[model samples]
Target: MKAIRIDEFVRDLATLSPKDVPSPKPKGPRDIGVQITHAALTHVDMLYAQGLHQNNGRHVKPPFILGNEFAGIVTSAPPSSSLRPGTRVFGATLGSFAEHIYADENGLREVPKQWTNAEACAVGASGAISWGSLVSVANLKRGETALILGASGGLGVMAVQIAKALGAKVIAVVGDEEKARMIKSTGADGVVDYHEKDWENKVKAMTEDGQGVHVVYDAIGAVESGLRCLRYRGRLVIVGFAAREGKMENIQANRILLKSAMVHGYRFGEDGRQDPTRTEEVWNGFMDLVVKESIKPIIYKKNYVGLESVSQALIDLGKHTVWGRAIVRINEEAERELKARL
Candidate 1:
């Protein structure tokens, strides 16, 4: 089997070499062996490559595979999982930068017939993330206002659609004028460029009372300066430190106390990696939105370069340079053609 693996933490994404590894073999009752057709690359992979998340024991420790989200066809499954062979699907399984991956059936979702492989790829991580990071953490309600940073990336794009679907007004922040327009395309009420010197102030000026948005989805935790953009009693959800690495948000506790504000931290892996209930909530919410045509994701380009491309993709993501979810696609033309049929 062809796969990409890291031998050591290196500065270069091109450094991790691709090689042939033994195909994955299935284990006991809960597993499903998937002939992975698409794998989405995210910043977590780059952080893992830089050895930033040593806390996770599952990381590649030299000659190890990395990746968590993939869309594929199931080749085998345990009856207990209720998944059948040859089912078109998408799912999350850590270490999926390979040709074949084995995932617990519950972690895998049956992709809808109308959806393409690229679209289904968004279901696992991007779709699930929108619910977990927005609904679970911020606890938003209809007619409320949300401010989302990094709103043009994989997760941000999904967040925008989710917010609008839930009937909330969204003020999204992007990297530049082009992304500003892109975020607006998702029905966001307003969009701001974080690169602008007064982006936070602009955000404050756009929402009610100039206090701040009712909910702040700060997935790019590199945005402590955006604190001034929060409303009184507004909740801020921190999903990752995309903007700031190893740097404290250093918010004034007094401010949070005075304004009755809330900061909710979320890690995608915490309790939801294999937890049936949390996984179910996230997936169910996503499917309902998709079926309603409320939260349509922008299926960015899917790359056919497998294994070896994972590392470079990760580094590109970490540096804010990836165009979209750079996926290791098993069959390039076939996947695109499937998506086109949708």
Candidate 2:
């Protein structure tokens, strides 16, 4: 089996390389082994490589595999589990950029019949986060309005479609006109270019009666301005800080106090630990959307081939040059099988 190994916490993507590692197997009856086809890259993977979590008391040391989510075929599974050998599945895991991965039955879900492995893999982390924030955390309702900041990026794009699927009027905030057009095509009612000075005001104006939106799904972490775009008692779901340095702007406490608003922070990994049931529900809801063709992952079309390309994928994600999500094709045989079926 081949895996991308990060021998040390270095600033350079050159540290990640393909190495032959022993294949992982199921540890127990509830565990399953998967033959990976595609692995998706996000800013979190880059943060892991740069040791961002290490300073914050996270035990992120070296000589470890470097991917967070994958889609693949089940090679081995216990008879007791619903997933059997040859089942196509996708889900989030700690280290998935490898030929084989071991996961518990609960962590994996069967992919839809229509989706290819690359599309399935593209949805894992971003899909879970989007569903968790809008459906589980915000309890977003139909006919309500949502303002999604950084709406051009991976998580933001998913949030746009999910919010729209939930029957909400979506206001997508992007950095430029091209992104604006792209998000507008995803069913957003309005697109606000955040690069403009009065972007928040524009969002407010687009809402009913200029009151503001029912929820602010902010992934850009522009909390101060995001608050200005919220209606009275609106919920602000903090998804990520991909735009800035992850340092939130100082917000006036009175803003939330006066508006009677609630601030909620969503972390996909933490949600699994805090409320495993809710996490599973979110994944299931996403799968349901897939089954209904209500949502499809917005994947970057460029093919990043093999373990050696993982570093380049990370670099593109860090630079924000890649739109939507980045996927690394790992298994040629699995890829062939997927294409044949399609």
Candidate 3:
């Protein structure tokens, strides 16, 4: 099996490449063998490559395959499992940038009939994170105004669309005019250029009566401004600290006290592991929105093909050049077949 193996963390992503590795086999009764067709590139992939992500040296160590989300065809499953041989599925797990992977039943889901493998792969982690932060944690309600920071990144774009599908007025805060325009096209009610002076005030003004947003979804470390954009008793969901390069940000207690706000730190994978029932509930809700609202994960315009392209894809993501999800096509034949059916 060919896989993007990380022998050790390196400072240069370009140094990382694919190699022939042993194919994964099912380790448990519920584990399913999957032939990976496509995988999504994320910031976390970059972090893992550099040994900067929390999961590195903790949940997983060096000398492992990289990548977390993938769409694949099941090669084997337990007789009692709903998934059988040749079932198309998408899921999140380590070692996705490979020809094959073995994942737990709880981590996998059947790909929607109408979706291509590339699209399904792109949605796995980003969709879960967005759904978990907004719907499960914040309880974002319809008709409410929600402000999304880092609105043009992979997770950010998914969050924007999911928030809109939930019938919330979405204010997307981005870095530039082009990003702002792109976010608007994805159903954001308004787009704010964070480069503008007093952008936080501008975000508040976009909400009804200038009262501020009902919820602030922060994927970047803009804690101070996020607090300012929140209305009384508003919820602030912290998804990541992309802007600060993974460094934690300090929030002022006074701001929370004054507004009676609630702040939530969201780690989608960890959350799902801790509470499988709630994770299922969140996933069901997310799929419902994806199907009913015709919500699709936005793929970047650039195409990354094959396991060898994984390094460049991760580099592009680190440079912040990818507007939406960066996807790498793994099994070209499988992807072609999946697209033909669609």
Candidate 4:
């Protein structure tokens, strides 16, 4: 099996490359072996590759495989597991940028029959974050208004659709007119370009009576501004720090207090690890939306084929050049098989 292994942290993403590595095996009864067909590229992968993410030298170390979200066919499974060999699935696990990976049964789910592996792979991380933040943490309700930051990026796009699917009016905040236009079709009731002066005020003005939104989903570290766009007693969920260049933000307590707002620092993966039951609930809810075709992965138009393309994909994500989710085709054979069935 060929895998993208980060032997050491490097400043340049271009220095990363794939190498032939031993295939993963099921080490526990709960482990399921998968032949990875496609994987989604994210800013987390870029930060991890450059040793900038907090997980670097902490939760994970060097000489480890890269990637987390992937879709593939089950090559092996426990006899008691519902996912049998030859079943198509999509899920999250470490070292997804490889030909093979093994994950706990709780980490995998059957891919919806209507979607290809490429599309299914793109949704795992993004969908989880959106569902967990809006539905679980924020408790977004129907007929309310939700404002989403970084609305054109991977997680942002999914967040917009999920919020809309939940019957909330969505206001998307993007960096520029191009991004604003791109996210408009994702069912955002209104689009605000953050590059515009007084954009936060603009977002507030779009809500009913200029009161502000009921919830703010901030994936870009726009804490101060996100607070300004919230209604009284509103909820704000912090999912990422993309705008801060992957660094933490200094959120002022006064602003939060002024709005009588509730702040939640949400980390989907960590949250799942702490409560596996909640993980199952979130995935189940997200899959219900998928089955109804209420939300889908917004894949980037550019195609990234093969493990060798992982470095450039990460670089593009770090540069904010890739718009929706960027997917890499890991196994050509598996991709062909998936397309044939589709």
Residue 279 of model 1, lDDT score: 61
Q: Model 4: residues >4 Å from true position, as ranges?
A: 338-342
Per residue, candidate 4 scores C-alpha lDDT tens digits across 80-100 of 999998889998888999999
Task: Estimate the TM-score for candidate 1.
Answer: 0.90
What ranges in model 2 sit over 4 Å off?
A: 27-29, 54-56, 245-250, 338-342
RMSD of each: 2.8, 2.2, 1.7, 1.5
Model 3: runs farther than 4 Å from truth? 338-342
Candidate 3 C-alpha lDDT tens digits along 45-135: 8888888877785887888899989999989999889998778999998999999999999999998877878888877778878988999
Better of 2 and 3 by lDDT: 3
Off-target runs (Cα >4 Å) in candidate 1 are: 54-60, 245-248, 273-275, 301-304, 333-342
- Local accuracy by lDDT, each model: 0.74, 0.83, 0.87, 0.87
TM-score of 2: 0.92
lDDT score at residue 37, model 1, on the 0-100 scale: 77
* lDDT accuracy of residue 322 in candidate 1: 47
The TM-score leader among the candidates is 4
Model 1: lowest-lDDT 10 consecutive positions: 297-306
